[model samples]
Structure formats: structure tokens, C-alpha cells
Target: MTLEIVVHRPSVSGGGRRVTVGGVDFGLARGDGDLVEFLRRAGLDDADQLVSGDSPIIQWRGGRAHEYGAAGG
Candidate 1:
């Protein structure tokens, strides 16, 4: 199964942007660096998998979703 990275822009309270992996909110991100850190902490290797356009869509197998990436499996 493919996972979708849903990003919520920073709110008016000055809270950093937030991202969710596979519908689960990971946490807030101040910028690209913070986003990457969150993704890594969530066990994602290639960040391209989170790209919805241009990037190749990864096909899912019978295991965890994050295991797949643009390279396909």
C-alpha cells in the first residue's frame, strides 16, 4: 500500500507546519529540515515517496508501506 504525506501549512499561532504519514499525524515541521527529520523518525528513507506529482509512484507489497519508494518493489 502506498502512503500519502499530507501537509498542513503553519497556522496563525506561528506553529510550524505539520505533516501526516499514512493519515497519522507525525508532528510539526519548521521547514524542509524539520520535515525530513520527522519523516526519518517515521522510518521513511527516500523523501521522494511523499511527492505526489512527477515522482514515480511506489507499488505496495504485503508488508509495511514505507518500505517501498520511487524505485518500485
Candidate 2:
């Protein structure tokens, strides 16, 4: 299955990283494996990590959040 991961810029106030799968925002931690697993269970793959910055939001098409670099930095 195909999934879209929307990674937003990290915020100190909110102090959190939000992950969006298929248009659904799944609030998650930087290294929350459970979140990736949840996405996999929901029909994703690989799921290693997701990379993002405080620039324009990035949209990646893949199976898991790992191969994408979802780990908040």
C-alpha cells in the first residue's frame, strides 16, 4: 500500500513532531517505533525514519516512516 507522510517543522512551544499518513495527522515522537509500526499495520512498509526541517513541508511516498526519515532533529 502507498502512504503519504507529512512532516512539519519542529516547534519548541508545541515541542513535538506530527506525522500525517494519508492526510491523517498522527502525532508522534522522533523515534517512536510504535508509530511506524502503527503505520505498517495500517498498510505501510520499511518505516525507518522521516527527515524534515523548518522549511517547506516535505511529502514522501513510501511504506514506512524510516526510509523517509521521520526522526525529529
Candidate 3:
């Protein structure tokens, strides 16, 4: 089965990010050190340096990045 992960980097919230995998929202905030650490253990990279124009980089079973970007206005 293929896993889908959505990484949201909202401009206003800083690093209060959200990652959704297979419709399950990982309501993980940067403030929650334990949760972030847990996700790190699960192979998620640190997202503190994200910006508005950044793309949602994804990693999969084959270890390749699926570069997804927002639609141009």
C-alpha cells in the first residue's frame, strides 16, 4: 500500500505544522517537544526552517522525494 503524507506550512503559524497520513491528522505542534521527538524517531525531518513558498517534500517506501508545490496564483 502507498502512504500519502501532507505537510502544511502555513505562513502565519510559524512552525505549528500539521502532517496528515492516510486521512489521520497528526496534530503535532512545535511546542510539544515529546511529540516532535516522537515523529523524528519515526523518520520525519525537522521542519523548523520551512517558508511559505516551500514545497511539501515527501518520502516514500522507495526513499524518493515527491516534490509537491502549491498552485500558482
Say which candidate scores most in lDDT: 1
Quote model 3's TM-score: 0.38
Ranking by TM-score: 1, 2, 3
Candidate 2: tens digits of C-alpha lDDT, residues 15-72: 4455677778677545456456545655555553333232222353332433324333
Q: List lDDT for all candidates, in order.
A: 0.53, 0.48, 0.41
* Per-model TM values vs. the true structure: 0.58, 0.46, 0.38
lDDT of 3 by residue, 24-56 (tens): 667643433533453454455653322222434
Tens-digit lDDT track of model 1 for 1-73: 6777655644445555557777778886555566667667767786544433324443222322322222223
Query: How well does model 2 score by local distance difference test?
Result: 0.48
- Model 3 pairs whose backbones collide: none
Error of 1 at 19 (Å): 1.0
lDDT minimum window of 10 residues, candidate 1: 63-72
